[model samples]
Target: MDLGVKGKTALITGGSKGIGLQTAIVLAEEGANVVVVARGEDALRGAAEKIKKETGADALAVAGDVTSDEDVRRVVNEAIARFGRLDIVVNNAGTSAAAPFGVVELSAWEQDLDLKLFGAIRFSRAALPYLKENGGAIVNVTASFAKTPGAASLPTSVSRAAGMALTKAMSRDLAKYGIRVNTVCIGLIRSDQIEKSWKQTAPEQSWEQFSRDPKHDIPLGRIGETVEAARVIAFLVSDAASYVTGTSVNIDGGKAPAL
Candidate 1:
């Protein structure tokens, strides 16, 4: 089905790789002109080029860090200057800290929050005016741990909770302008971070065995693909979800026991 977002413009943070990249592809596949933002210039260019080649849709890659206000400005500007308008904004740029709660350092907490929290704040602030004009949609990617807390999920869970609060508050404030805001709380997915962990901890095992085994703690019987998460994000951003806002949708494949 057409997402009814074709010919619209979308700005996605952390669009260089992982779920963010997949979301960009999904949006482009539906005919949206997409501007992807991330810090790695090379990866951003590559991802954008690949999306354009595959979907034949307009795609732009803006290299900038989400932690910097200047960088955030550049991303917003690129979206407007290039696409002429912004209809969808996905705050998907964030880092994680997986250490034990007590072992998580103040520095790590600050760094992660700098990107996850301030990134959303700055991106939304800059995009709000333009979004207001278009009656846009905002989907902030958080983590399932915000609802299902775990001992090993430090900083990420706390930061995600804060993001959820932001989503609800923004939805309330922006609803007047037809700017819908929502959150997609993610769970364990096969992404660069998870791949890195598997590489270091259990290089011998296939991802299928490592992520599916009940002993590995996931109930889905397998690890999630980035595309799986992206499909949900794409739907939320679509006009089909016009009635959805101020809500957090969990795409944890039952790994997280939160209702």
Candidate 2:
């Protein structure tokens, strides 16, 4: 259906690929002006071009690192300058880091927090004034591990938990301004990141073996697609989800245990 987000402008971080890219495409298809932010200029431009070509929507790309406050500020400012206003913000920039606590270095934890937690805070804070002006939405992309931690998932789980708390706190505080804050807790969705993870963690395994239908961990017996997560995020940011806020929606294939 009509998501009712036409003409609305959205800024999405980590939009160069994976779920973020899919989200941008979907939003553009729904007639939203989309600004995709990522660190790599080439990939960001490619994503922007793809969105524009596929959906015939206005799509812009900005190269910036979410871990840097300056970059975050630049992204928000540029988006507003280009679109004149911001109606949605998707803090989707992050990487998955899993290591045994004992073996994990302090630096790793700090970096993880900088990217996953502080990144969202920076973008949300930067976009708050613009969002409040028009009553908009913010969707922070977190992980299911935040709700159910697993062994060796140290920094990621901890950082995602903090992100969930951030979402709740922002939702409560921003509600008065007509701004909604929520999160999409991702599960095992197939993406470039997952491919890299498999290559790094199990180089010996063939792609078929590594990507074989879940038929295991996830109850659905298969991994999820990037577009699957993107659609949920699109709904959360659309007028359709006007009443949804301060909540976490797991985009897993029923893989997440906690309700």
Candidate 3:
């Protein structure tokens, strides 16, 4: 089935790698003009090239930090300048800024909130006009910890919880304009961040072993692939999920405890 997104345009932050890059590829596969935003010029260029080569869709790469208002302005402006319109906005720029509860620095807390919470707010505000005009979609990438926090999940868990609230608030407000707002609460997925964790915490373990070690804790017996999360995101942003809004979907392979 055509996702009914052909000729549409999408902008995904942190789109240089992992789930973000995979989402861009999937959207491109559905014939959407894609603009991928990230801080690394090299990675952004490579991601855009890969999308173009694999799907024959136009892909533009914008290198900028989402935490910066000036950079966010440039990202949105450049995307519209090239694509002529914005149909989807994926706020996926974030990392697990985990710190022990008591020792978590004030700066660290501020940083996490700024990047995960305010970044999504800024993107949504900047893209709201265009999305409203086009009756588009906004999908915020959050974490399952937003609903159920675990030990040492500070900053990230708190900020992601706020992100969930933001999604619901945006959905309520934007629905009048026909702009759908939703969120994908992530579980363990293969990504650069996870690789970094493996190297740091389980240096002696092979990548395969480290990857599987956590599976025993999850019902699926394996970490989710980036594309698996990406596919759910693609659907949420497509006409396929036209009736889906003001909701948060867990793409965790039954890892999250809450419904």
Give residue 224's error in model 3 in angstroms: 0.6
Candidate 2 lDDT (Cα, whole model)? 0.91
In model 3, which range of ten residues has the least summed lDDT?
Answer: 214-223
Q: What clash pairs does model 1 have? A: none
Worst 10 residues of 2 by lDDT: 207-216
Candidate 3 structure quality by residue, lDDT tens digits, 216-254: 487877778899999999999999999999999998878
Per-residue lDDT tens digits for candidate 1, residues 1-259, read 8899988999999999999999999999999989999888999989988898889886989998888888888888878888899899999998777778889899989987888988898998999899989799999999988986778888888888899999999999999999999999888788888899888988998987778767657666777899999999999989999999999998877777776
- TM-scores for candidates 1 onward, in order: 0.95, 0.94, 0.95
Q: Give the Å error, residue 77, model 2.
A: 1.3
Best by lDDT: 3
What digit string (tens of lDDT, one per residue) describes model 2 on residues 1-259?
A: 8999999999999999999999999999999999999999999889988998899886989999998888888988899889899999999999889988999999999999999999999999999889999999999999987998989999999999999999999999999999999999999898887788789977997866776645437887667888999999999999999999999999888888897
For candidate 2, the C-alpha RMSD (Å) to the true structure equals 2.0
Number of clashes found in candidate 3? 0
